[model samples]
Target: MKKRWVLLVIVAFVAVGCAEPLTKTQKGAGIGTAIGAAAGAGLGQAIGRDTESTLIGAGIGAAVGALAGGSIGRYMDNQEATMRNQLAGVESASIQRNADMLAVTFKSDFWFDINSATLKPGAYTELQRVS
Candidate 1:
């Protein structure tokens, strides 16, 4: 009985966490859920030495972890929005978000010449403006 319930819960969580096309919040939540479940299961086993207690603890931990992870993802989303707005006018530049990191790519057309290692004259002004 207790074993079945624990297995069911674990399976359900794994299904959700393994789903594809996940948003940032969902990705974070999935990671959090896995970590929280492992920690909770360990603590439950240590304290109660029972499957039922493990299930309950895992459920609680998963919920808390999801909330925390979602909050962080939301913050990152907002930060990306702000960065996009700030860099909207940058020439030949593109912004890319990789999880918690932001990548900015500037084309060399405005910064350098083909097969040249020296910076173009306009590049100085552009760099100043960006800085």
Candidate 2:
């Protein structure tokens, strides 16, 4: 009976360890892609394209958005490490697993230009290096 109980406990532990954790990055990407696709489709329709064109545009936009988000996540991870080293006063940073990918979120103040969604030249350079 004791041996059976021990085996059950071990099995439970293993199950817990093997369970997949939910990932915010994956969720964000999915939501972002959906929104982007909708917006793309709307724009395509306004421009007098057919349903087929709208769908194609949506697919392309979703792919590009996912790639951009993934790239930005990686860049932020690297930037966090660099900042930690240089500042030495900042909190430790970590990259979380997101499905088969890795992700990191950054403070908006750290990476973006004021009133602009476009990446700064330095940020673009870093992203290029990453790619």
Pairs with steric clashes in candidate 2: none
All models: lDDT?
A: 0.81, 0.62
Residues 1-131 of candidate 1: C-alpha lDDT, one tens digit per residue: 99999999999999979978766677788788888888887888788899998988888878888888877777777877877876788867789877669998999877889999999987887677655
Residue-wise C-alpha lDDT for candidate 2, range 20-39, written one tens digit per residue: 85344554566667767877
Clashes of each: 0, 0
Task: Give all TM-scores, in the order shown.
Answer: 0.64, 0.40
* Residue 59's lDDT in candidate 2: 82
Off by over 4 Å in 1: 1-20, 98-100, 112-131
The 10-residue segment with the lowest total lDDT in model 2: 86-95
Number of the predicted model whose lDDT against the real structure is largest: 1
